[model samples]
Target: MNLMYLTFQEDAPLYLGVKNKIEGQISAFEKLGYQVTCSMWQDNRFCFFGADSFQRPLDPAKRLMKQMTSIANEYIGGHPFDVLYLRLDRVSSDMIQICKTARANHVKTIAVEIPNYPYLADYMRNVKYAKTLGTKVKTAAKVAVTAADDRLSGRKLKQYVDAVVLYGNKADSFFGVKAMNGDNGINIDRIEPIPHCADTSKDIAILGVAGTLWWQGYDRILQGMSTYKKSRSDGPALKFVLVGGDKTEMPEFRALVEKLGLSEDVTFCGFKKGKELSDIYKTVDVGASSLGCYRRGLTRCSSLKAREYCAAALPFLYAYDDAKLKEDTPFALRLPNDESPVNMDRVVEFVQHCRKDPSIAKEEREFAEKNYDWKTIMKQVLEFAGASMK
Candidate 1:
């Protein structure tokens, strides 16, 4: 069987997690005995991996959407793939046309994955990513042209797409197709569990890891820490270690830290991987998942960070609704789904409780194995797509 996997992310550091995930999904397909070809757009060219290796240069003069639709039509018309899987770049008319092309070419099992269903706000929020006057103006101009483009495009999804893969969502149908819902899974065998290292005698270390736009609602953490610092001088010291976030959006956070006098307590370790990341994980007492999802107009989600934490057997904290994890889940501490400050005292108690609980490691690892493994999750996705699963 031959599978074609398409990712909309460029080959860049900012998209490293998404790239790694694509690799994991392809690896799962191979393990399941399928010949896989992966495609990515980078350096103004379409880069395809596996038995089909080629680079198709994108026209620079025409707009991006036009180029992608033409490329999808030309390529799918010539290729034979048993399954055509696309990681949608939000909703766009180009994507609708791309799916239409694949179906018209008699391609079997065409499916698209939308990371967020009501993602228009998040998509429009990209305009705030500009750090300079030039980029700001450019992004602003692009937003004006694009804000209305995706609205009607969503309705066309059901016409050609066989399945819409949704993660950690309870929705039965989306875009007029039955959704293939699952957690944001990890390559469990590849991701070694972070050894449990909860030492609460001196200070408890809480870790947060994310890429691109990590909205953990750390402002609430800062507020809690500030209150904790003012209220008590020495309740088992708490330290926050944040990993992977853009510096362009760090100013306000930095200023908040300064204002709260927590500059010395929070440590930022830009980007880490391999052994360096492993070493940091060894020192972490607990991990942090998305705390400010409500701010993004999200009430529930399947967090990749939470998945990584569970795979690492790291006990963690989260506020919003997790796809598989419940508020009563023993291995995790759940907070309120609001913008209020996280209570530092309660956090300390939670850390102490986690450290004392002997079953934390076992429960966390078991939970990860049960729900967050890529092979199992992808098999279900493949089955839902009407593929002849082995």
Candidate 2:
């Protein structure tokens, strides 16, 4: 099968989620003996467009549309693709054109990874096309419910797509998509939880926090930890380690820690990659997924960090109510609500429990390997893209 993958951004050195998803799928397709061509708006030269020297609201839509149309016309003109796999927002005129052209060429399949909500400008664009286009657009229900509030609008979007692949039972009804129950007949070969391995073993009970702490309730976790310190005095010294590239929000976080007299207990290790990040994960006794309340319907979808923590086999503490810490996940614990001051005690208790039972850490790694590994998810995605085992 010849597959063409699409995205909105230009390629950059940093590994973003959309890029990672595309790369994972491409790797799976190649492993299955498929020829994959990834065409994006920009190459490695420019990480992002419209950031420099461009006026406010610089629209790359026109350029992107031209580029996509040209690529489809040139590469897929005479030689039709077996599948035009799109991981794009619907609003892109380029995406709409690509789908229209792909269907016109009688391509066997056209699949999309739907956006969380259909109201975003990009999503609205895609929803508009899906309404008219007779092609099948695959999406996740966990995503659809984020932006869509109106029942009629959600149903209208679903009608255009052929199938909906839901992440969990809760998402199925919300988005009105067909439930594959995370087992959509797709083969997942490399699904395994990762184990946290530290480079040098340390005595302190290190708490590793990953992802955008500012965007996802990092303040709540920090505040909770501060409150927990006031109540407890005797235990292995607990240190907080935050990992991720974005550091714009670090100053405020640092200020809070200092105010709480936690300067010595906290460490910020800027952007890490590959084995470095994994090694850091190993040092920590517990992973923090301090997601706050699902304001405007945000936390309904599955979390990548939660999965990664499980993969590393590090017990994690999350803040959301609906967030499920899978039964197999040994070290994983969910807090009632990280937003309020009340949950601080619970956070401290959960951390203390993991410290006593180190075996739970081993269980978390085992569970991650079994379910949340990207290898397994990619395999399922490939089958959905119509790859045959033969």
Candidate 3:
């Protein structure tokens, strides 16, 4: 079988999360004896690759149908793809046309990896950080209009796609259930999690980010750390080493850290990659995960950071109450839904306890190896794909 994988950030070198996911899927599909081609957006153009992939840009400000038609005429000239798989986080009018055009070309199956919430939810959340009224108003209006367009697009895309693949085990009710619903014989696949391994270790907790964008709630970490520091003068010092995200929210995070008086407690390591990232990971005692955002709380998340922490044999501190992880899961410690000072104090205590018991980190790594290995995740994905075909 031949498959075409498409996502927005296909060609970018950054956006580690998107890159890891796409690469994992591609590697897995190849192992399953399928010819997989990836089509991604990069450099204001669409890049299609399979040993000899090429890129072409779409004319901007064109209608959705026209855009799809113009691209499809070129893309589908060689042969029909067996499946058109989209790994996008959200739906858009252009996405609807992309699917429509793929179906029109007799692509046997269409699939999308659905996230916990619409992309608009994330956009609106980020808009809260905008300093200027004009910027906030413009971004908020665009998000609202996009959200409406996505709703319409989703309703249409749901009918066109043969399968909808979700990440976590649980469904997010706030995201609206129309796309996730399997009422129309649409194959729904909830693939297993994938693990990210690192050779490094550290004694301090690390909240790592790449590029600029504050989706992971770094501000709350400082607030929590300040409370932990003030209350636990006698306890061991809890140091938070932040890696990356300087470009995304360097100014805001820097200002917030100063306002909270956490300069002594937290350290910013700028951006680290390759050997530097691995070296730092070795010193890490615990890995920090998201505290969710203001809008959705911590409902259903597929935290790549948490998985990496576990893969590196580090205990993870997560704010979300995950239904998939049983109470006995040794890999993670759950924090309160709120990132309040009181709750963060408990998180600090948990870290201290983990520090004393070094075995917790080893056990966490074991759990990650057993459950989150990419090979395991891909097996499930391929099995679901096979079942869907039947």
Which has the greatest TM-score? 1
Each candidate's TM vs. the true structure? 0.91, 0.69, 0.80
301-362, model 3: which lDDT tens digit per residue?
66766666666666676666554466556667776556453255555556666666667666
Q: Rank the candidates by lDDT, best first.
A: 1, 3, 2
Is candidate 2 or 3 superior in lDDT? Answer: 3
Candidate 3 Cα outliers beyond 4 Å, as residue runs: 10-14, 57-73, 76-78, 123-141, 167-169, 172-203, 210-213, 246-248, 294-298, 342-345, 355-358, 385-390
Q: Which tens-of-lDDT digit does each residue in 71-117 have in candidate 2? A: 54544455556666555443334444556666677666655655343
Q: Could you tell which candidate, 1 or 2, scores higher by lDDT?
A: 1
Query: Alpha carbon lDDT of residue 99, candidate 3?
Result: 78
lDDT of 1 at 246: 63
Worst 10 residues of 2 by lDDT: 46-55
Model 1 vs. true fold: TM: 0.91
The lDDT of each candidate is 0.78, 0.52, 0.61
Clashing residue pairs in all predictions, respectively, total: 0, 18, 13
Off by over 4 Å in 2: 13-18, 40-79, 89-93, 115-161, 164-211, 293-296, 320-324, 327-329, 341-344, 379-389
Off by over 4 Å in 1: 58-62, 126-147
lDDT of 2 at 333: 66
